[model samples]
Target: MKEEFQNYIDYHKNKGGTGKLFKFELVEYKPGFLKLKGFFNSETLNPVGTVQGGQINSMLDDVTSLLLIYESKGTIYPNSTNLHSIHHRPLFEGEVIVTAEIIKKGKTIATIRGEAFSKDGKLAATLIHTALIMKSE
Candidate 1:
């Protein structure tokens, strides 16, 4: 199962739109929790030379979704219904660590919390994600 999950993430990281661009690495993964690390390059920078809010949000969203998938062992698929992010600080160069934990897992719905931290261990943003869990056909 671990190998499968790793392969899944690798495939997306090499092929998916955001994954390909952000180059996110699946640093750690376990049931109900996961961590992804990446860097915000020049392309992700805003006009002021800081990482854009939307890019951070996208990273959180992707990490949360991947966490759910890993927890489910690929038996269920998730569709995000709601996402709320709060920015705590600006991020420029260096590594970004995204950690996600499942808050509640139900038959039909799930809630997850994700936090993004800079290389220096400062919190950059936090996100709450609500997703609909559906069985794979």
Candidate 2:
């Protein structure tokens, strides 16, 4: 990861609201792509002892949004328009590894794909996220 990207993640993990709360860790990065590792702890579990669907969606949203921000070099911010998701299996309290890659980036809209895998490396979920690209202030 570039120092700037690391700095961005560090800043968020330290101070940026839900990013700080979720504690997402960057595992790998490159232009338009990123890998993040997140822990789905006991606090996130639902009644069935599996991580809640909303938590997984939040992580995927962060992954895709952060990738777009990184690729745009902070010049553009992506406002989510849609998130189409599929869950293959329930995720328990453990590490969830997620990867986000840019599928298409237009002047006004961007599309990104994200996948989450359980600690055992089984596919847990997938999301196709679409966002409207907006200029940063």
lDDT of 1 by residue, 3-112 (tens): 77677678668867887766777688777888878778888999999999999999899889888876666688788899999999998866889999999999899999
TM-score of each candidate? 0.90, 0.92
Candidate 1 stretches with Cα past 4 Å from truth are 1-3
Task: Rate residue 53 of model 2 by lDDT.
Answer: 92
Best by lDDT: 2
Candidate 2 residue lDDT tens string, 1-137: 56777777776677666676567777999787899887777878899899999888888888898898888777888899999999999999877899999999999999999999988899999999999999987
Best by TM-score: 2
Residue 89: error of model 2 in Å?
0.5
- The regions of model 2 sitting more than 4 angstroms off are none
